[model samples]
Target: MFDIQEELKKLPDKPGVYIMKDANGIVIYVGKAVVLKNRVRQYFHQSANHPPKVQAMVAKISEFEYIITDSEVEALMLECNLIKKYKPKYNILLKDDKHYPYIKVTMNEEYPRILKTRRVEKDGAKYFGPYSSGFAVNDAIDTLKKLFPIKTCNRKLPNDIGKFRPCLNYHLKKCLGPCQGEVNKNEYHEMMRKICSFLSGQYDEILNDLKAQMEEAAEQLEFEKAAQIRNKISSMTQLSEKQKVLSTDGQDRDVIGFSRDATDLCIQVFFVRNGRVIGREHYIFEGEGDEEIGYSLSTFIKQFYNNVQFIPSEIVIQNEIEDSETISQWLTEKRGHKVSIRVPVRGELVRLVKMVSQNAEVSLKLFKDRLKRVDNVNEEGINQLMKLLELEQRPRRIEAYDISNTGSSEIVASMVVFIDGKPARQEYRKFKMKSVEQQNDYASMQETLYRRLSRAKKEKEENIEKPKFSDLPDLILVDGGFGHVSAAQQIADEFEYRLVIAGMAKDSRHRTKSLVYNGKEYELSAYMPLLRLITEIQDETHRVAVDYNRTLRAKRYTHSELDEIEGVGETRKKALLKHFKSLAAIKKADIAQLMEVQGINEKVAIKIYNYFRNK
Candidate 1:
C-alpha cells in the first residue's frame, strides 16, 4: 500500500532520519539525510547506480518513514539511535559497543570510588574511556589505585565512615581507610582532584600542585604530609618523563587511519592527548569490498563519536569524507569548541596518519591470520568430533543455542550458525523467550528449539526454490547439560526430524568442560582441537544471547524512565534520546536544546528540564 513515488513527491528538503522497512514491515535499514527529498528520491530514481547492498535493500523496501530534524547533526544522532534500537540488518553494527570499558570516578559521592564500567550514567561523575578493551580499562584502574589512595570500596561514606574497621587494603597501604575515618575529607578530595588532573594530561600542573603542597606542609612542620606530597611529585614527574611527546604544540588530536581486505576493514584510532600518544584502539568490521574510503570513514566518524565523550580539537584522516565541514560543525557543537577535520596529504600529520594506517594494516592481517587458524582448528575439531561420536557425516553446518537473562526480566535466546567451522553470521538469529519467561533455562531452551525447528520445517515445506530452512544444520549444540539435550530430543521427536543433539557442560569454574550426549559425557581434552572449537562456539552463542538480552533490558529500562514523564510518548522519547544521544545528555540538556528536538515544544521542554532538575 505504500507508494514510493507518491512518498517521494511529499518528501521535504530537510534534515531527518529515514527508516526503510522490508515486506514483513520489519525495519531493515536506517539512515540520516541532509536533504530528505534529494536523498530519498535518489534511491528510487537511480537504483541501478547504487552499490549492490543498497540496491538489494531498495529492492526489499516495502515502505519507508522519515522524521524531520532541525539540523544534519540532529539527523545523524537520530540515525544512530534508530539503528541501535532496531539493529537493522544492513546497517554497520558495532557489536563491541559495550565491550570497551571506561574508568568511572564517582566524583559526586562524599568519598569517591574509581571503578571500571561499560555503562555511562549521568550522575555528575567523570568517566574516561572506551578504552582499548575491558582488560585495558581494568589495568588503568589498577594502576590508578596503586598510584592514588582513592577508595575502591562500595561502602556508603559519611554515614558509615566510622562504623567498620579498616580492611586489608589499609594494611597493604593501598587505601587510606576512609571507611575508618583515617583520612580527612578535604585531603581525600584533593587526591581525587589530582587524579583527574593526571587523567586529563595535566602532568605539570599536578607536579606543581604537589610541590606547592609539599613546601607548605614542610613550612608548617607537617613532615608526614610533606613526605607524601614529595613522593607523589616524584612519581608524577617520572611518568611525564616517560611519555613520548609527539608534538611541541600541546594540542589534542586523533589520528584516523584504516586498511581493508576483500571482506573486512580495520580502522586504527590513535588517541593523542596533549601531543602524547596515550593510547590506541583497532576496530575490525565487515566491508562492502569496493566501498570508497571516504564514505566508510565518514560513517565511522558519525558512529564513533556517538558514544565517545572526548572530542579532540583536531581529527586527522588520510582521505576526505564528503561532509567534512558539517561533521566539523557537529564536533564543534559536541565539544563546545571549534573542531577541525583535516585530510593531511603531506608533512608530519600525513606521516602520523600513515603510521596509523600501517598499524591498521598489521592489525587486520593479524586478525585475518587468527581467523584462518580458528577455521583450521574448527575443521579439525569437526573431523575429530565425527570420529569420536561415530557420526555418519561431518557437521559442515552446525547450530548452537544459548539462553541468557538477568533473573527473569529479559529472557532471550540466540541461535548461531557455523558453516564449515566459520560463523555464517547472516544466518544467525535471536529469539525472545515467550513460553517460559521465568528463570527456568530448560523450559526456555525447549521453547526456543521448538519454535526454531518448527519454523524451519514449515519454511522447508513451503519453499521449493532456495529453501532457507531446508539447509538444516548437521549438528545442534545447546549451552547446557543432559536436560537441554533431552529437551532438544523431545522437539526432534515431536517434529519427526532426526537430530544430533549435544549439550556443552561447564565445570564448577564455569569453563566449558565437556560434551554431553546420549547419557554419556565426553571429557574435554586440553590438547584436543575439538574442545577448543566447541568452547569457541559456546562462548560466541553466550555472548550473542547476553548481548541481545542486554539490549532488550536497556530498551525496557529506557522506556520506563521516559514513559512516566507526562506528554512524552514513544515518538517524543525517541526524538529526545536521538537528539541528546543519551539519558544523561538529555538530563544535562537545557530547555533550549530540549525544545530544539523534533516533537518537543517550549512547554514540554520546560517540563522535561524541570523533571530532571527536580530528580
Candidate 2:
C-alpha cells in the first residue's frame, strides 16, 4: 500500500526528519535533511550511488514517514531524540547508555550540603563532573568531607537549629553541627567557597592556605589542630595529583578518538575539566566497519551529548565530522555558552587525541578476544539444545513463559527471551491475567499464549507498523511440565505457528531436571552446557513473573479508599490520615469534622462523607 515513488513526490521542500521502516514497521534508519524533497528522492533513485549499508537499509524499506520542521536546527534536534528513542538499526549507537554521576553543592539552601546525584537542574546549585562512575563521585565527596566539617543531614537549617540534639557526626568532628547553632554563618559560607574552589581543580591556593594555617597553629602551640591541618593538606595533595593537568588554560573540554577494525569500532572519550583529565570512558559499536569515520563520529557526538548532564565548552576529535557547525550550535545552546567542535591539526591536543585512539584500539582487541570465547560457549549450547529437541534449525531465539500469582489475586504471566544463548532483556513481556479469576495456572498460561500469538497474527495480517509483538520466536519454552506445554501448543496450533514447543521440568528440589517435549522427557544432566542454558531461561522467566506478582501485591496493599475520592490528592490524603489517625475514624467522622482538616473544604468533605456512607 505504501508506494515509495509516490511518497517521495509528496515530500515537502522544507527541512525535516525522515524515518525508514521495514515490513514489520521497525524503524531501520532515521535522517535529517535541509530540503526533504531533494534528499528523500536521492534514496529511491536507481542511478544514485549508495554505500552497502544504505543499500541494505533501502532494500528493507517498506514504508516511510517524515516530519517537517521550521529550520534545519530543529530537524537535527528531532532527529537526535528519535534516534535515541528508537535506536534505529542503521544508526551508530553508543552501547554504554549510562548517565554518569555528579557531585552537587546545594547552594540554594541556607546551609548547603554536598551530595552525589546523576541529574543537573537549574536550582541555584553548583554541579561538578559527569564522573566516570559512582565510585569516583563518592571518592571526591569523601575527600571533601574529610577536609571540611559540612553537614550531611536533610534538616532545614536555621529553622531546625537547636530543635534536636546534634548527631554522632558532630561528636566525631565529622560535621560542624549547624543544627546545634554552634557554627558561625560567615565562617560556614567561607568554608563552602573554599570547597567549591577545590572541586574546580584549584589546588595550589588551597594547599598554600592549609600549609600556612598548619604553621600558624603550631606557632600558637595548638599541636593537635596543627596535626589535623597537616592531614588535610596531605589529602588535598593526593586528590590533586589524581587529576593530571593537560593544559595551562584551565578550560573544560572533551577529547574523542576512535579505532576500527573490519567489523567493530571503539570510541574513547577523555573528560577534561580545568585543563585536568579527570576520567575516560569507552564505547563499542558492532558491525560498523563500512561506515564513514566522519558519519560515525558525528552520530556518536549527538547521541552521547544528548543524554549527559553537562556539556563541555569544547569537543576535540581526530577528524572533522558531518554537520560540525550545526552540532556546535546545538551544544552551545545546551551549555548556555559558546561551544567549539575542533579537529586538532598539531601540538598537545593532537597528541592527546592519538593517545585516546591508541587506548581505543587496545580496548577493541581485548573485547574481541573475550567475545570470541563467549561465542564459542553459546554456539555449543545452541547446537546441543537443537540436538536434544530434534529441532530442524538452531533455536536462535527462544522464548520462555511462566505463570505466577498469590491466591486468586494478581495472576500474571511473563515471557523472557534468549537470542543466541544471551538474554534479550528488551523483548521480555509481562501480562496480567484478565479472564481467569481463580488460581488456575493452566487457564492463565492459555490466555497469555492466546493474547501473545493473536497480536502477532494480527500484525502479520494487517501489516501493522510499530508492532507490539513483532516476530515469533524460533522455539517456545514453558516453565512447567506437560500441561503448560499442552496449553501453549493448543494456542500455537490455532494460529498454525509451527516451531519447537517444550517445557522445562524440575527435580524434587525445584532445580532444572530435563526438557519435556513431544510427550517425552529429554535428560539434560549429562550435558552441562545445555542444562545450564535451560536453567538460566527457566530462572529468568520465574523471576520476571514473581517480580510482577510482588509489584501488584504491593500496589494493592498501598491502595487507600481516600485515593478514590475525586478532589483528594496526596496532600489532602496525608492531611486526612494525620488528622483522623485512621481510615475507620475518617469514615465515622461527620462532614464538619472532615472539613476541619487542612486543605479539605466543605465540598471535598461532603464528597468523602457521601462516598463512605454509600459504601
Q: Specify the highest-lDDT model's number.
A: 2
- Estimate candidate 1's alpha-carbon lDDT, on a 0 to 1 scale: 0.81
Put down candidate 2 lDDT per residue, 153-179, tens digits, no spaces. Answer: 999989999999889999999999999
| Runs with alpha carbons beyond 4 Å of true place in candidate 1 | 1-3, 46-48, 105-113, 119-126, 148-151, 154-162, 171-173, 177-190, 202-245, 331-339, 345-347, 374-615
Per-model TM against the reference: 0.52, 0.61
- The residue-by-residue lDDT of candidate 1 on 209-297, one tens digit each, is 67898999999999998997787676666655544566767688888999974346788898876677767888887543335678778
Can you tell me which runs of candidate 2 are displaced by over 4 Å? Answer: 220-222, 375-615
Among all windows of 10 consecutive residues in model 2, the one with the lowest summed lDDT is 523-532
TM-score of 1: 0.52
Candidate 2 clash pair list: none
Model 1, backbone clash pairs (residues 3+ apart or across chains), number? 0
